[model samples]
Target: MRIAVTGGTGFVGQALVSALLARGDEVWIISRKTAQDRTGQERLHYATWQQLEQNPALLEGTDCIVNLAGESINQRWSAKAKARILNSRTDAAARIAKLVGALRQKPATVVNASGISIYGTSDTKTFDESSPAHINDFLGSVVEQWEESARTIPAERLVLVRVSLVLGNRGGAFPLMSLPYRLFGGGRVGSGRQWMPWIHIEDMTRVLLFCIDNRDIAGPVNACAPQPVTTDQFGRAIGKAMRRPHWFPVPAFLLRTLLGEMSSLLLQGQRVLPAKLQQGGFDFRYPTIESAMENLVGKSSKPSV
Candidate 1:
């Protein structure tokens, strides 16, 4: 298999690229710059957006396309930041679609990243692949527009991968999220009862691979774990995994005061389940919070954490 990945240098994209290479799949990484040392890596190649614009044939033989390019939403939600967050996703999707249109042989599968916020924040609601989108906030709207843009791609099978909070130790929100726990200051954020739909980075990458292999699977597939934890439960799990005390609680008002609209990401969440993956017989390596934490933080000891 040959895959073309946008945002290949990002947290999720890097994981996916590594997995693809390990499985002996040729990977073509499309990005803004190509400076990585590709020495001795015959199957790994990088192409800048400028190069792709000049020759779409750079990915001519690509069998699959995974679109994960987007601006990070972790910062303060200033007006400019909001525009960038939204535009980056839609613009990336538009470019992928146009590139696919220009391809001599379009890829059969497109796994475009979406957000679980499309279901809106709900303490009582359980969302699945079949659930209707009930977007309310800025991220939700951005995801809605992002999915719309992805729908324009000329793939025979398009999988709108609605990802939740991916838990990994290397380069994601996990390290920062676990920082307070490592400092023995971990506890619930906001109401503590808000749901935190999540998946381990391992399972997240495998789910994308499953999407490409499973031809029958398409549409808005939630890439979250089966068991959704509350924010309190998540913090407790983190503390336990890191051998720390979950005792420090940050006030919701404080987060809102500091992060503005972005605070909603940590303060509010929906219960999302990977219904399509489960139904399609996709096995998750870390299906539960405890299991995910154990894998990510290690048992009995932490490694360079």
Candidate 2:
């Protein structure tokens, strides 16, 4: 299969691309970097975002297109930074949608990335794909518009994957979150009561591939583990796994002052469920925080994959 991926060099994208290459699929990466041989995977190719936009026909015969391009929301949310965050995501999806429209042989599937933040931060609510977007906050509004930009993609199956907090040894949120724990400064953020929806990196890649292979799986799917945990619970799990103390609770105001609006990424929480994926009979390798933390923190949590 020939696949085109935007943000193919990113954490999630790299994992997904590696998995695809391992399965002998031809991968075309859309990025700013020049093409190079990766692990002798001669089938791997790279093209700039401009290259694809200028020549949409380049994606002509692609079997699938996965868009994971976006600005990182881990820093201070300045006016400029917020604009970059919104534009990076919306523009990437819009560009891909345009490319899909221009292609003579459009891809069979187009998986556009989103986030569980669409449901907003809720301590009392458990969200799934069926929940409505909470357009009240920054991240929520961003996700709403980001997915909206891909509404015009002309694919047989258009998948909107609302990803959650990805836990892994290599990359994603676990390292940063676990750092304090390892250093004996770990504790709950805010009230530590916010629900955290997370998935193992392995499961994250697997779900992307699952969407590509399963014809019946279309529309919005929550890419999270079945068992979600509270922020306090996660910290304690990490503390135990790392043999550290999870006692310090960072004041929410301090985080707000430090990160500005971006603090929501850390302080806010959501209990998201992989309802569609589970109902479709997908099994998760690490379904609970205990299992995920055990694997990621057991052996120093070094970058793997």
lDDT minimum window of 10 residues, candidate 2: 296-305
lDDT of 1 by residue, 1-305 (tens): 99999998899998998899899999888888865855578999888888999999988878999999999988899999999999999999999999999999899999999999999989998989888989799999999999999999999999999999988888778889988887777888988999999998888999999998899999999999999999999988888877888888899999999888889999888988888888999998888999888777757534321
For candidate 2, lDDT tens digit of each residue in 181-273? 878999988988989888889999999999988989999999999999998998899988888898999999999898787778777788888
Error of 2 at 104 (Å): 0.8
- What's the distance in Å from true for residue 150, model 1? 0.5
lDDT of 2: 0.87
RMSD of 1: 1.6
Q: Measure candidate 2: CA RMSD.
A: 1.5
Summed over model 2, clashes come to: 0
List candidate 1 stretches off by more than 4 Å.
300-305
Q: Which candidate ranks first by lDDT, i.e. highest?
A: 1
TM-score, prediction 1: 0.97
Per-residue error (Å), model 2, residue 223: 0.9
